[model samples]
Target: MTRQHVLRFYVALIAALTLGVLGVGVVGVTYLSSQTLIRNLFPAALLIAVSWYGSQRRVLVSESDIWLMGTVGYIATLVLLPFPLAVLAVAASKGLAEATLLAKKQRHSWKGVTVNAGGTILGVAVGGGVFASLNGVSYLWSHQLDSVFALPLLLVMILLYNVTNELVVVGAITLTSQENPWSVFWRLSRAALIPEISLALVGIVFAVLYHSSPIMAAFIVVPVMFSLRAFESVATLRRETVEAVLRMAEHLDFRDTSTYEHSQRLADLTRRLASALELTPEHVEEIVLASRVHDLGKIGISNEILLKQGPLSEEEGDIMRKHPVIGAEILDSYSMFKSSVSIVRHHHERWDGKGYPEGLSGDHIPLGARIIAVADSFDAMTADRPYRKGLSVDDAVERLKAGMGTQYDPKLCAIFIQILMEEGIYAPSEAVPGELHLIAGGRASGGRAS
Candidate 1:
């Protein structure tokens, strides 16, 4: 099915399930006393609303996993309110909070609102219904000694709620991206497992505190939200630092005669090839960043060597070969760039142990480095330099095929070539036989090595 059709069906299914759950909840509606309304119900709803607002102050741990506060509010709401009230409170609080916090363009469309609300409702309904059915709600609602035994049930509810909520959201992502649902689910689950469990425990704490004194719960939840926002600020600053480094790398393009925007183009290609290989989003992001700074060590090379128009002498070649090591050292100074260091340091490493600062071969080379090598060579071969005209796309493809398992990973080369062909970027008919002309030293001057 088409992506849109899949998304539509999935969203419709969530909406239907939400309506059915609400219908079941309506049949068992129990009126709250004035004291109960003032003490538990009102406090639960307000806590959820506050928590929802706090949840918006989040940090993105990965492309798919967003870590946030406010599970405390949802769990507390389920603990203190009836099944129908808990579901409605979570939906209303979250939807309203997002509406208030998010910009118009960020919301995408009203369908997003429906999916989010429906998903939360299903999560709370399923988890709360299960807890109440098992007679664990009484222990949770009252500050009783028996609450110790009910803790396990609360854990189960949190697990069910998180799993149900995550499944609903991951289902939408899978449908829209046409990705394997289990893969998407696993990535999201693994990324958020610790934080989700921790937050669920916090929610249970807040619920227990409320049973004793609502004012005490309020004091606790507020500080927790502020702590979350503080963490969000730190994450934002780190991201800005990373962006600043990327900008610096881009500026370095001006330092060379034949390598302008070379890193940028490689980064673009790396993203496509990495994603095509079904790598995780975080892995794709890391490789793309690594490709952008793969040649960062070149800053240490002399201007004459960097801008040389012909093949280098043995001595000059040795100096040029030090760049990958130099680049890795430059990045190693910064903890944020730790992940990219190996990739930058080893991008020149060959598949058959013939290339590099290190003579690592085959699977010994880091996967990110291997991916960057193919992207680097392709960009270099297709790009015009001071000494020679760039090869045609077909010629570059031919070169890549010829180098497979020697200069590049055979599997990666094959995959990259297929991607180029499918994208219509390489036209075989336009290729000329002499386009693969060798310069002195059996290498194309100012090409891949540059």
Candidate 2:
């Protein structure tokens, strides 16, 4: 199994075991008349709850996990003594989980995860220590300090702790991912404050309701902030990655043709097909990128072959087949483009295994490539070419229908035809005088015919 699958399985197993243990402990506590059973059960319950909650959230655990665990830890410390020391232990756990999850999600190296977790732990320690010191001072000056002063001070400390918790979590994750700490901090801070503010308000409500220490209620803020921040961070990363890929696609188009209007049209068509196929946004993006760079391998081919006046000879055709391979190689060099390379390499391949360098066919072909092939073929047939006048959209649709299950993927072909028909995309070919002359002139134009 893949690492992700294994991790998920392990998490599921742990959660199940924790629940089982908690169940057994509950029974034991009820049967046995010992306070020890109840005491021991609380810690186990806290551990199980925290771990299970963290596992289930996938992206971010509920803030309650940290609060409950911290509360239990603090209570343990307090009966032996007193004060809000439990909050610190809870905050530390929160920081550690945040850092670990971030590292895993970002695919950071082990060393990076270690450093990030360590940093988070350190930040929590410092923040918790400061709060503890202030709390001690407040206890000592109980008679001297007024309720108004003490309440405001508690609020300030809670706000500081919540802010610091967010920063530490984001910082550790970003550092582990090798992203700039400042950039991560700034990006998250800008987008995440609303959620933090909301959580802070909730903490205020809790403090008012309890009429106890504000610091105890302050624990609620940590999880709320962490959840919001983590979700926003992940969403932002996805959006940025998609935009970057789209920009790269635009670059590819600009390098080949002055007008990327055709690329835009193809992108629209691809999106429609994707929706019809019920593809996820991630899959749609992959398809779009693949379609955008469908002709990328042409860059490696000589201008003569790419701009050939007439039909390619047998030898020339052989050279043309290499374009897909070359394109795949170029895309494979970059990590971001890896998902798109297969589509680029195999868009020319036929469903029947009769196409290109590797004739492996049927389900073996990548679905993204299959979808692009139909779109590419339809676009190519309808677009003006050096050797022939562009076919009318109606004609292009007919040609695509004719080639279904032979040269193109049947399912994708049907989708493309449906899209074209639905959008009223088929129209009579528009002739350009220059383009006609260029095609008619053929070899005389030094292969500028196309």
Candidate 3:
């Protein structure tokens, strides 16, 4: 079963166990107590059961009105009897009801299984613990049946039970959902535990001061439930934004054959080079992103020229060169892409001021752009093209080193070669001529002057 299903099962089992235990405890206490104690304990147990059911419903609906109504009903019933049994009965009832509702709802909407299961488990544990503690305290205080430590011990037990429930629910959700356990734990805790625990703490402090006021304690559960809803909404939005960006990248890949693995390889190479050069994580991410989208302007190029097997004529070459400009323009139009425009536009620029478009040389080029230039060249040479076989990794490193200070920055070239060596790409039979083979090697083969 899915994580949600397992969570639901656990919540239901806890609820059932709580009710069963409470019922048996109340029955045995009634059998052993005087008539007055039995009368008092039975009503208190009923009240606790009802409260448990109401709290469970509140968890699923997550509506303040339902929770308030449930709490009010529990209080009204408890006040009418002012008996420990009545309170226990109400709490257990609420727990059972909430667990059932969660199971039913999860059956319909399985996508929210993790959230549902987590909330349900936590809700039941919290509600059950509160009910049990209140019952224990009332019996101890009213009947003088226990020591001063009894109520405090019960409270600790309740807290431990709630914590265990949270862990189990979080674990089941992670396993079933195939999500990282830590991530699931954090997310569920932020959505459920943080708010609930905050309110519970307030209630605990209030109870310590007032001496077991169930009515007052019930008031804090409302806002905690609301906080859970808010956290879930935020998490959902963040997930959607991430998915949207990935989809956009996928769409871009569909437009060009060369783009299929280009961005990924470029990103990898750029990250390696960035690390070799001792750049920080922030700088590495920027360089990697820039490398991935460096040729984004090529989207504007016609398929006719993009897929051409032979060398382009002068006019076509000129048009092809305009892609960087087109890419820069496109990036400049988006506020989010502004920083990447330089890399897209200047990746073609050489170190000696002989590159295309702006012909920016040396330090004039943006560092990110220069890094992308090296990565893009490396990837392009090693990747197979329609008219050319992919160069070996060794030859590619050799070409990168051969072009240092002429077409590429010498320092960057050194780092790039170091990265290749470190990544085991510089081994014999794997190396290729890289950018030098694509540019200089081509010119040399044709007997053309540089």
Error of 2 at 288 (Å): 1.4
The candidates, ranked best first by lDDT, are 1, 3, 2
How many backbone clashes are present in model 1?
A: 2
lDDT of 3: 0.57
Model 3 ranges with Cα > 4 A deviation: 1-246, 428-450
- Listed in order, each prediction's TM-score against the native is 0.64, 0.46, 0.43
User: Can you write out model 3's per-residue Cα lDDT over 33-125, one digit (the tens) per residue?
Assistant: 576675555545544554454354433212110222243334334333433344344545554654566676723443343343334334444
- Model 2: per-residue Cα lDDT over 315-357, one tens digit each: 9899989989987887787654666788888878898899886
2 or 3, which is superior by TM-score?
2
Prediction 2 global C-alpha lDDT: 0.53
Model 2 RMSD in angstroms: 17.7
Which ten contiguous residues of candidate 3 have the minimum total lDDT? 60-69
Clashing pairs in 1: 72-203, 297-327
Q: List CA RMSD, all candidates.
A: 8.5, 17.7, 16.8
For candidate 1, what is the lDDT?
Answer: 0.73
10 residues in a row with least lDDT, candidate 1: 441-450
Residue 159: error of model 3 in Å?
44
lDDT of 3 at 372: 79
